[model samples]
Target: MDRSFYSRSSLIINTIESTISGDRVFTGNQPDDFALAGLLRNTKTACLLGVGYGGAVRAMLAGDPSIELTLVDNDAALIEFTGNLFARSFPGVAFTSETADAGSHLREHPGCYDVICVDLYSAVGYPRMVLDVGFWHDVREALTENGRVVVNAWGLPEQLSPLAPPSPQHAVAQAMLAVWQDLSHLPCRRNTTFVAPALTPADLRPPVDDASTRLSYEDHLTLGLIRLRGASAPVLLRGGIGDAGQPAPTSRRAIDAEMHARWPGLVEAVTGRAEASADFRAALSERKLTDAATERLLLEGSPAASFAPCIASAKAQLGELSMAWYGEWLCDEWFRLKALDPDWFRMSALWQAVCMARTPLGAVWPWEARLYDMLSAELLDAGFADAGV
Candidate 1:
């Protein structure tokens, strides 16, 4: 697709200011989950497929004015609304809306972009159409030979469980991993990373574990900020929602009834337990061990692979990012949201600077607690996060 194909209409204006420091952001994670800010640091052409509020697009504008951007979303209002807002600031960039699914657009616009980001969210479980089948082929075709596709897979409802903090990134990474693995079937390529809370340094990096080969994952973990590992993973998730959604949370009774009917089976599938409930804090503690050990063991699957760094700058904040993960929602999401809703999305990401000092992924945020409640309250909302979960 040409510039005309990249520019469309209708958008929104709803900004969420940080509850703490008045910062704005997208949703959960920070600007760059793996410091992709650096990856996009010099990128000249960029596209956002599922532009929910379109914050990443704005980030690119601020980072490099020379960059060109295209944002595509199915929502006509959002498409039109954001188009106008950004049009004023980014005269040269493009914004468009389509009555089509992201995959269809990619198919039509072959080898056209430097970066293609899929920010799909819904209840059908990660827009299955985009994951396998023809979608990957179209996406590959739509991108420049050296282009990158960044997908933000929303985690599953059970994955959200107010019962505990969500494992959003794991699901995100896995979604891309499946695609990478499938594509690599051609035999000339290999998916670079499976960055996970499950993986340990030994699971990915060279085992020498000494100078010239000290594992960065461990350093980040010890410092508290885990860097992206493996090759630039195709996906990065925010949580793990199951194929099926959970019951509505309009009331504790409805939640309980639904839990009784479908939640237990789902929980059993993920945790392998029979109807036992989990706390978010407890889950985080246990998951850290389970995920790390799990990653270490996964190495056998790819003998030729070695661990890649999870963060572009693992030393940033001196490892505090890892520590504050559980306590504060990644402030980065705020900036992302800010890009869309400047009013509501305040820049409170720096709160991590302080919160990280108090807890290491142990404490939870009060507002996020309310957000989960709201997110769970709407049975209809699950559709918003279906893709990439």
Candidate 2:
């Protein structure tokens, strides 16, 4: 089968056609994947822990023709599917696929790959082993000097409503805390890709010089890019450990506070108004207002109108169904549904709602503190690392 044929999958091609018709588009997801491919510009060896849709594999080949790749996946069928696809797809590129656990493979071939792509996840969530600090330690041992480990953490708010309170039970939250905890000592930089609607396939055509990648892979790239729009950026948790691997703080409260400090104006606008803080404190102590009344006051009361724009942008970008369930679903139920829908704008709006719903009494509704982290990553990726607000 011609590799280009694979990009014709209905799952993504239809999205491209729809997006192109509307022309409502943004940067899409390739920049980050392209950046990842760029990491192997001169490298000869790379390893992928999960095959997913084989986007990273295509990326590595596109960047460097001679690079050798070892792809490990737990599922035998996926291994066969992608393995056969890559075999026929890029004959010139050295390739290997193993049917085994990623951790097991890393342990067997320690200090082997120049780039280790850790994207291991099942439909339910990230595997429990990915959360193990010891597994990360194994990852560290498996890297060559100057090598990089990129772990895929889905920070997108597809399944959880932003209206819900943050909890440790969420799988992504747990994985993030674990990643920082295990790799805190290592020098690292976080990179994020914001979820956006698909762009026209014409915008992402493969290089003309590489006839091998033409038609065949460009569609896949286009599809992969859009699919990733809803995913959290993978963090390059690289470099040497400091202070004997002093742990990074993973407390939800501490993280939220840090996020508030970084983008105070946005946080205030989304969560509460400048003057509303006084009213919130009063409402908590006076005990005169019911919780429902207080929530109404915070969300629709004085100065609440200021956040309407944020909510509007979120709704317009995220769609109605994505936002409607914000304050309605329970924690786990919301997580399950959000994963199926995965809308960034909707999540952003609901996050503001979550913030606005707050009282001095304490967090009552469900919300993801990681929302701040996700938004922060998006801002950073868009070159706002030094953004004043």
Candidate 3:
């Protein structure tokens, strides 16, 4: 897709036959070009459900011109527009265009595509069908043996509301998890491309022949892949859709109490190991005197004070470590501690912290402030933030 198709302006709206069709309102950066390029990599045949200006089709064709592409959209005007645009832009590539409902098309054609890209969205938001579990079941049944489904989903809510109905993005994610073997997310600032049967970062490369397409794919991977499973997956998926899990704490004291109860031995489990590590002790000893003094004030003699200094010193020595460092460290700790207390570690504050830390700097989408708030509550209750550590 060309740069013009990827609109930076979120306010731009396009209509087909007086029906609101395309806009960046709920789905920011709809038809994520780089994300589509990554998902369609190495695919022989692909079906694109929603054709908005043919950006996704252009991207898929650009990556691999020989792909047997199929375009399905409810709007005849869009299919015609895309056909005309492609005639001028990509005269050599051939693709079948069908005017039909996405769900009906998937039901009619089963196990035909190596890759199915679902970018279905109405003017209001994701249509009711996209949120239904039965719809995802149909999507799963339609996939080839090793087929992958890539969805352009709205960004997930930072913190799920227990009382509120799940957002379209969250509902879709949970539904996919229920039906698919695995689910992974390629998150951007606004829209997140969700992939079923989780793909790794290594799988996000473009065809070697297309240098520009390769560059675009590489740029999108900077944020990295978010595997949605274990604690990282939303709690609502515990017993499928209507189960909200536990109610979120409404007050500060209640939230702290919940955190303390959730991870009873978190501080001791993580920090004890850190304190015992000779490398951490050596690193702390080598810190500059001024820096050590500042960190000591930050530590303030908490239980984790000894090892927290090591983290501070490491940050100071390394200049500025990306949040990836913290994310990786958190994951390692979670795995190590989970064996001892599986229930305690599952869906605990640590995972929330990991999610927050791993998010690319400056790319955090709207409604994500709650992630930071949750992490803060954990740190405070665990005595890390209270001591300024």
RMSD of each: 16.3, 14.6, 14.3
Question: For each candidate, what is the lDDT?
Answer: 0.35, 0.39, 0.47
210 in model 2: Cα distance from truth in Å? Answer: 9.3
Candidate 2 lDDT over 1-389, as tens digits, reads: 23432332222211211111011111122222432432332455788787764545655554344567788988888788666654654343457889998888989988887667676654454466765767876776777765655555432222222111232122332333343432211001111221111122222222223423432222323223322332333222222111212322224444344334434433333334333444433322232222223234334432222233233223423333223234332232334434433332222323334322221112323343433334344334533332101
Q: What is the lDDT of residue 173 in candidate 2?
A: 29
- Alpha carbon lDDT at 311, candidate 1: 18
Point out the higher-scoring one by TM-score: 1 or 2.
Answer: 2
Q: For candidate 3, write residues 1-389 as lDDT tens digits.
A: 23322333332233421111122101113343323433444677788888876656645554455678898999999899878755654455478999999999999989888788888764445566776779988887787877788887653321222113334455567667778756755433224567777665345443334333322322222112221121132232323445434433323344345434533343333334343443433433433321233234224422222233234322322334332233333343434444443322323324333333322222332323443343444434433332111
For model 2, the local distance difference test gives: 0.39
Task: Estimate the overall C-alpha local distance difference test score of candidate 3.
Answer: 0.47
What TM-score against the true fold does each predicted structure earn? 0.42, 0.43, 0.49
Off by over 4 Å in 2: 1-37, 40-42, 87-94, 156-389
Error of 1 at 48 (Å): 0.8
Report backbone clashes per prediction. Answer: 88, 13, 0
